[model samples]
Target: MLSDFLHEYFLKLSIIVAVFGGAFLGIGIGLVMRAGAALDGIEVLALYTLKRTSFTITEIILGINIIIFSFAALKFGIETSLYSVLTYFAATKTIDYVVEGIQAYTGVTIISAKSEEIKHQLVNNLGRGITVYKGERGFLPGKFDVSADCDIIYTVVMRLEMRKLKNLIYEIDSEAFVFANTIKEASGGIIKSRVKH
Candidate 1:
């Protein structure tokens, strides 16, 4: 009877460990993502929205977890849903650490007929270096003839300053075409930033 009781207790303990262990695993993944400057799995979707959409990063993240939990409830059961929600919250604080910990940097690409003018402004005003690449223009309708001699202008700047840079560039030349991207890993050339903020 004692052995039987011990076996049942151990089984219960194992089940409890499994539940919390899954949560701990999720939290660990979140932290690693926070530290490593990259996202894993569902986090990738959040990262994509962060760059491509008007939505705030936090909103995107929360929305994703909500969807995940809702799906889990639908497919698995209420228990899975509850666990997912709990785990998601536990993992979320890692985002704050990740955002504050990682240095945010922007890569700017400009294609303009007035590349030289923009380049000058970028150099003199922004105090940053830029690279120019020979390229064709006008695959897009409005983009055509904007630059007779096509050159691609590229620069990297801190994320905090990206808005100001964009506004400045627009102020200089509204017709100038620009693409901004978040750089997770940047090396070579003049782009140098701390791996973490």
Candidate 2:
């Protein structure tokens, strides 16, 4: 009876370890990406090779994972391959979530013909501070007269505000041009905009 109890206890402990170990490995991989570094392991070899070769990272990772899975099946049988499959899925999904979160909070740049109006709306209406850059813009076949003074607006807003801000701009000028991308890290000069939550 005591031996059976011990056997069950060890089995439960082993299962717990396997599940959490997989999750921990996934978290560690996420941290490396956050740090703008690669996770130093067999899984990241594809990432490194792709960077060096200037090939697509997604394609390389997919190819390498398939090869690894096949090798695991041939050498260690299906059980080992199965465990690796679980770990690979968990790590990739977790890393993607973290990377997306990082991107959402990055700064935003706005290019619009109604630069002054947008600037006023952002600062006074939205209560968010912004910077302006002088520039010129022209569109269409043969109409290339530049603005005497155009403003390029830059601001950092929370991820949640992105949709609302875009809608606001569209309401004002449906023809407005806008683009946004993720930034890894930022500092100095109030990155957080003051918004009424």
Question: Which residues of candidate 2, in runs, are more than 4 Å off?
Answer: 1-90, 99-103, 145-148
Expressed as tens digits, the lDDT of each residue in 1-197 for candidate 2 is 99999989986775565567766776776677667777556547766685588544434554577677988799889766766766665556555556446335646788888887898888876777788888777766586773445678888776778887898778887887788765545667756666566
TM-scores, each model vs. reference = 0.52, 0.56
Candidate 1 residues 1-197, lDDT tens each?
A: 99999989986775676457655654666566556545555667777777888765545766787887887787899765776665555545455435544456788898877778788887777777789899877566776665455889999987777787788878878888889986756767655533333
Q: What local lDDT score does residue 75 receive in model 1, on the 0 to 100 scale? A: 83
Q: Give the lowest summed-lDDT range of ten residues in model 1.
A: 188-197
Identify the runs in model 1 with alpha carbons over 4 angstroms from their true place.
Answer: 1-102, 139-147, 192-197
Residue 38, model 2: Cα distance from true site in angstroms: 11
What's the true lDDT of residue 3 in model 1?
A: 100
Clashes of each: 1, 0
